[model samples]
Target: MLPSTDALLDGLLDWVRIETHTPDTAGLNSIMDLVQSQAEGFGATCQRFPGRDGKGDHLLVLSPWGDHAQKGVLLLSHLDTVHPRGTIEHDLPIRIEEDRCFGPGICDMKGGAFNGLAAMRAIAESGVTPPLPARILFTSDEEVGSPTSRSLIEDQGKHAKYALVTEPARNGGHVVTARKGVGRFTLKVEGRPSHAGARHWQGRSAVTELAHQIIALEAMTDYDREITVNVGEITGGTGTNVVPQFAQAEIDLRVPTAEAADEMVARITGLTPKTPDTKLTITGGMNRPPFEQSDASKALFDHASTLAAEIGFELVGEKTGGGSDGNFIADRIPTLDGLGPDGDDVHTLNEHIFVSSLKPRMLLLKRLMETLS
Candidate 1:
């Protein structure tokens, strides 16, 4: 049997209290320690890889049942959150407000991770062996993009037949079947600098060149094609009295298809400086490939939807603009994302999960583990 809602909330709240910011290695390991202990207590063997490149450690826990050599379920969750260290103490405290439980990292995915473990624990206690073995990989860096853990996740994906990401569910319990590819780039403009008052004609303003380029970049957004290019950050100029010699803008790109990603990348990278004598440089490329819906993924969603209905709820699949690690393995294998608890206000001061969703979502995950072959 699944645990009571109150009991599950108690376990999940314990995790919310820990501030595991993406860069806080110690905080991340603290939560991972708890994860390892709980997973091992339920007969899962865990492998701990130390953090590198100023990131937190990652935990890989394999189910006690099934052969270690077999290709099985890959359960993914990131322990690191975007919230800072003192978010809980100052901003979003652990409190039950009506049906929502507000806390730092509660909905954005610590809740999902905890409930996943709870489902496994229930299975272990009931003496039921899953049809296929399960491996839960708790990663540390995902909020700032999985810089250090991406390779590790892909390596693990090679041995897995199915990938289920416990990212926060969307649009009221909708699992993600597709996501836009994400790309980041930096555009730098270099120009001749001179005193604005003394030699305005001789100097080329890097900031002015950057402004023109920004307009061109923003104009690339095509809602019809589901492509967006945003120049999110810009830095330029040294003083008001001097013409700027250098300017830089950070660009964000999203596309719904691989072809769109390639096309947009070429367009962005091939930009030529409009201002004569000013040098323009572009750096960076696609970080995640688009997660297009596939037949296998559709079948997986159908199965999950059936399970959700049996558990007394309807589950839907959505295509989101946000990218997840699901993008990494969706093309490689059958992948279903946003299996986490239903919630709203993710990555905000009011971030929380619906307390009522705890039991049903847990039941759904438990059933998937038992029934997915």
Candidate 2:
């Protein structure tokens, strides 16, 4: 049997209390230490990868029941959150109101990560060996696009038969089977600066050129094609009386398929300046490839849905625009995402998970670990 709802909430609170912001190496390592200790206490062998580029360390814990060399089940989770350190003190405090356990990272991911650990611990305690070796990877840089941990995740993917991501369950306890590819880019415009009043004809306005480009970029969005281009941020100009010499805009792109991703990339990169005497420079590309649904993934979800029904809950698959580390390995492995606790208002001041949903989700994960062949 899984832990009681209150017991599960207590464990999750322990994790939510520790703020593991994406870039805070110290705080991240602190949480990693807790995870390592817990996994070690449960007789799981662990390997720690020291973080580089000022990111937090990563932990890989393997179940003691199976051979370490064989391809097995990979449980993917991340410890870092989008909220900063002081978020708990001011923005979202740890509190239980009705059935919701409110905290900074509880809903976004920490709850799901803790549930994965709890399920593993229960299985270990029950003394029933899983059919396949269970490996849980706790990564540190997922919210910032997994920049430091992508290679590590992919390396493990090559050796795994199935990948399960503990990202937050979507819209009322739905699992994710497909995700759009994500792209981030910066566009810069350069032009001659001159006093607006004295030599208006001699100077080119980079801000004006950037504004035109922004309009064109926004116009590229096609809802029917499932492609979106957002000029999220822009900065330019020094003074009102002078023509701007430099301007830059940060863009975000999403595509539902590899073909769409390639087409959008070419379109965005092929931009030219409409303004005379201005230079346009673009940098950056697709950060994550599209996780299109496949036969293997569909079969995996069908198994999960069957298991969920047996466990007395309805399970469905969803395709989200947001991407996760599951996007990294979905094409290569049978991956199921959004296996975390059900919650609402993730990555906001109101972030929280439903206390009632804890035990059922834990049981679902435990069953998946034990029964997946």
Candidate 3:
């Protein structure tokens, strides 16, 4: 029998009370405490991976009963919530009103994490320990792109035959099949400075040179290939009277292909100085690798769909513009994501999770573990 929805809901409320925003060390620790306490009850072994000190931390829990070399799944979810420190701590009450459960981090991840534990428990009680293991990794920095935890995810991902991510599905519960690769770029332009009024002819404007670069950068965006170049932030001149000596701007680029990522980085980094009077510098590279759907991923998706069908949910796939830790692991192994409870308005004050969706979704996940045998 599957675990009760009441127990899953209680566990979700327990997790949401922790307030694990990445920049808050205390919050991260609180989340780790919550995770460890919960996992320990089931005889699972928990480990803490200290993030760059003062930058928060991540937690990993391995159920002692499964084996990886045989054929199991790797479960991934983030512990960190985007909420500011102390804002949601002990304040976001878990409520079931009509169709949804209202609370911070409930659908985004905490609810999903609880479901993973529940699924394992269901497996254990069924007296069917699969030949493969299901490894759960809950990172604290996924809200900020998992910079410190991607490597670890990839490392564990390669060992598992399948990967299941617990990120809320988009378009009303359609799972994710593909996502774009992301990159960051910095543009620095330097030029000769002179009094704007006095030696105007001898002066070269760095900001003026930057304008040309920005235009060139924007033109590089190819909508046909789903590539975009955005100069998001800029800063420059110190005084209105003086010619600016330095100007800098940050560029965000996204591509659908790995080769496109390489091409974009090379071209953006090599932007020639517009004027001999200006020197330019560009830095930053690909962050999240593009998730190109492959055979392995398709197989896992098929399996998840089968599980969802048993629980009366028709599974469908969708493409996402946003990146997730799923992209980090998918490239290395068979990965399936967007399997968590449905929700909307993430990163906003109105964030919410579907109460009705929890039981069905949790049941599907519960079977995902039991069927592993």
Backbone clash count for every predicted candidate, in the order shown: 0, 0, 2
Q: What is the overall TM-score of model 3 with all chains considered together?
A: 0.92
Alpha carbon deviation, residue 233, candidate 3 (Å) = 1.7
Residue pairs in candidate 1 whose N, alpha carbon or C atoms collide under 3 angstroms: none
What residue pairs are clashing in model 2?
none
Best to worst by lDDT, what's the order?
2, 1, 3
How much is the lDDT of residue 175 in candidate 3? 87
Which runs in model 1 stand beyond 4 Å of their true positions? none
Per-residue lDDT tens digits of candidate 2, residues 44-125? 9999999999899999999877876889899999999999999999989999999988999998899899999999999999
What is the lDDT of every predicted structure here?
A: 0.92, 0.93, 0.80
lDDT of 1 at 189: 99
For residues 52-150, write the lDDT of model 1, one tens digit per residue: 999999999888788868898888989899999999999988888899999999998988888888888898888998888888889999998899999
Candidate 2 residues lying further than 4 Å off, grouped into runs, are none
lDDT of 2 at 234: 98
Candidate 3 per-residue C-alpha lDDT over 1-373 given as tens digits, one digit per residue, 9 for 90 to 100: 7656677777688777777777887877777877788678777788888878456777777766765456567889887888776566445555677777777777777777777777776666677776677778888888877878888888877777778888886778888888888888899999999999989888889999999999999999999999999999999998999999999999989898889988999999889987876899888888888887889888777888998887788999987877888888777787777888888877776678877677787777767766654
TM-score against truth, every candidate: 0.99, 0.99, 0.92
Task: Name the 10 consecutive residues with the lowest summed lDDT in model 3.
Answer: 85-94
